[model samples]
Target: MLTAYLTHPDCERHQMGADHPECPERLAALRDHLLVKGLLDCMQEHEAPAASDEQLQRVHDRAWLLQLADQVPAEGYARLDADTLINPYTLRAARRAAGAAVRAVDLVLGGQAPNAFCAVRPPGHHAQRAQGAGFCFFNNAAVGVAHALAAHGLLRVALVDFDVHHGDGSEDIFAGDERVLLCSSYQQDLYPFRDSHPPAANVVLAPLAARSGGAAMREAVTQYWLPALARFAPELIVVSAGFDAHREDDMGNLGWSEADYRWLTEQVLAQAQASAGGRIVSCLEGGYALSALARSAAAHLRVLVEA
Candidate 1:
């Protein structure tokens, strides 16, 4: 009946370092803002459960999963890559963050919730099927999409990402998968620095220039994403909601604002209503500046809770 809000306290314990941009405080700031805005009042909140190994393996290689598990440290941190590190609680927190998305999918598809928002951290989207990178251990949105198709018997699903950086991991995992449509928008010349190779038809890339601002993003969505999404007629919609592109965040130079995030979410919701039975599972991805992250995330949630 209401939007399902899923999170776990353990999500905050997985830290890269005191100075890492993907710190635990990102979640805390957004959560506090949501509470203060009373957005949580309109939603049904639930603590996220750990995703089963089977569920995670559907979207990730079992060997890679085992490797990540083995890398968890007992005292300090283990480096997964230049941009990713795992502390003692990292694996558990990553599992819970990913599990939140899976549970959100379950709740929405089972008629328990009209839609859902996963507020967990250690944001996922950059973690590919075989390797974890970009401050991510598991691809949460991909895991959710896999579950919707494999476990829930859904054939058509869509994932929408609006992070400042390309979701190369999501693209890697879902490329050539006709059953799912992946529409992503990111600033050009950003992190992960993917090549300009031809993407599969299922994966639509809308790369904006630095400081292009929200106008370019909205135009890309209108010209590219809407057409593809309409044709797919998806049964569910999963969102990789990121806010680092905001003008104040300074993570990338897309030069967006809270209003842009609000508008983007509104478009996603409209598409969901068109063919997905209003089913949505939105997960937190990238947002750095504490004040901006809090404000932008709160803006996104206002649309979800109200819709």
Candidate 2:
């Protein structure tokens, strides 16, 4: 089966501002590179549906949802935080961005696709259960993980986040849930400043020093993530695929390159094949540098498609 490519045109409409790093053009760059590399032809494409309130509530607080609805401006932008902003279409776009993750899970688990990648905008992983912050309104990967556990009856679901910054939101949601294991590697002392606290037993946090480069990341995965995943034997593997750690990207000081992304994806794919019937769902989280994001995402997708 081919990998599923899930996205929505509405994702392009949720712009924070002209100077925001999480711009709509990021999606266009990824799509353009995928097209140029002929990666799109190897996959099944689907337009993402808007996530219903029930689905969103699975990972986000009801009050937060209603607050976001109330904050949506008819024309201008409403700031959720110093970083997060909402415009007229922001809520709808956030729903579709998160919905892409849920649909990706269904597609992979239903055997319609070997795996799926969600190339949507207003990237998630920063929003926690009760609040939206750091340019994230809803935790997309967490929503999908919840769906896999509640809707699909999957007992063991693993979430792997390789974003430059720690997935505080995911960790917050799955902190004590033994059914889910979250393994993450992020730059030490980065944005949101969340490395101070100790993680739960099911949560594996690998903190890499600033400018650690790809070698450190590989070592972290081998020593920290792989062992935990092997012991957990997850029924489904979900990836919070963020490319901002690329050497060319200025989002963080990490020195990883496209090759690192390809290698990391291969490792995740091997784990999926071993324990999850090759079922994997990847959601975009970060990657501001357009050219590097495009190239790195294309590299990651090439592995997903086995191209």
Candidate 3:
């Protein structure tokens, strides 16, 4: 089966502002690089559908969903928090972004695709169960995990997050759910600082200090993430893939490179191959610097698309 590349044009319409880091151009940059690298040719492309309210409710509060729908402005931008903003198209974009993750899970689990990658916007990882923050209107990765567990009757799912910022939203949504194992790594004392403690026994966190290079990340993944993932023996693997840790990206202080992303993808692919029938659904999260984001994402996709 081919690797699936999922996205939606609506994702490009959810622009926060001119100077905002999480701009629509991020997706364009990634696609341009993947095209230039000939990576798109090897993959199957799919347009993401809008996630249903039922799927969204699996990971987010129903009240919060209503609040977001009511807050969508007819013309200008509405602020969700200090960093998150929504324009007229934000709701549709957020739905598509989240839908890409759900569709990715469906494709991988149904055997239509060996694996899948979602290249959408409004990076999720910080939004909590009842709140929208950190440029995320919906918790996309969490939505996918919930879909796998509740919709597909998956008993065990592993979520691996390598964003420079912690996946606090995922932690919040899956806090008491023992069916999901979350193995995450992030820069210490970064944005959305909620890594005080593991909210559940299934959550494993590795916080790296500022300026720590790829060596530290490798050690963390090998020691913490891999071990936890092996013990869980998940039926599906979900990746909260973020590229902002690249050295060229100033979004964070971590010193990662495109090669680091390649290595990380390889590791996740290995685990999936061993335990999950090579099923992985990766969703785009944080990655601000356009060039670095494109290069790192391409490196990661190359591994996913390789035969």
Candidate 4:
């Protein structure tokens, strides 16, 4: 089966202020790059739907979500935090971004696709169960994991985050949840800083030093993530695929390149093939530098389709 590519126009509407790096151009760049590289032609495409309140509740507290919805601005921007802002369409866009992951999960698990990539934005790794940060309003990957567990009765789901910054929100939501194993490699001393020690047994937080390059990331995945993932033998695999670590991206100092993204996808594909019927639902989490994000995402999608 062909891989699925999911995105939405609403994602472009959830923009922060003009100077922010997580701008709408990120999505536009990815779309343009995939088209230019002929990557879009190899996959089935779908526009993301708005997530139901029920699905949002699986990963967010209902009251917190209600408060966020109530705070959305009609004409201007409302600041959720120092870095996160909500425009009139922000909440709807966040729901749609989260829904993209949920739908990708449904599609992959149902055998409609071998794997899927969500190209939506307002990146989700920094959004916690009850808090939003780092331009993230909803925990999209967490929402997808919850859907796989609740809807498909998945026993064990593995979440692998390769963002430059730690996936603190995902750690918060899945902490102590025995059914899920969370493995990640992030730049040390970065945003949402405290993930060196996860509060749960299933979390393997590998923080690499700045300028460590892709070799360090690859080593951590091979030595730590792979073993933990193999032991868990998950029924489904979820990826918080962030390309901010690229060398061209000033978002972080990991110095990764497009080849690194492709290599990482290959590793994840191996784990999925071994235990999960090659099922993977990757949600875009972070990537700011327009050109690098586009190239890295294209490399990742190429592997997701070819593998």
Q: Which pairs clash inside model 2?
A: none
lDDT of each: 0.91, 0.92, 0.91, 0.92
Q: Ten residues in a row with the worst lDDT in model 1? A: 195-204
Model 4 superposed RMSD (Cα): 0.8
Off by over 4 Å in 1: none
lDDT of 2: 0.92
The reply for model 3, stretches above 4 Å from the true place, is none
lDDT of 4 by residue, 13-56 (tens): 88888889989999999999999989899999999998899998
Off by over 4 Å in 2: none
lDDT of 1 by residue, 105-138 (tens): 9999999999998988888999999998888889
Q: Taking the tens digit of each residue's C-alpha lDDT, what string does model 2 give over 219-269?
A: 989998999999999999999999999998888999999999999999999
lDDT of 1 at 164: 95
Q: How displaced is residue 215 in candidate 4, in Å? A: 1.0
Candidate 3, residue 267: Cα displacement in angstroms equals: 1.1
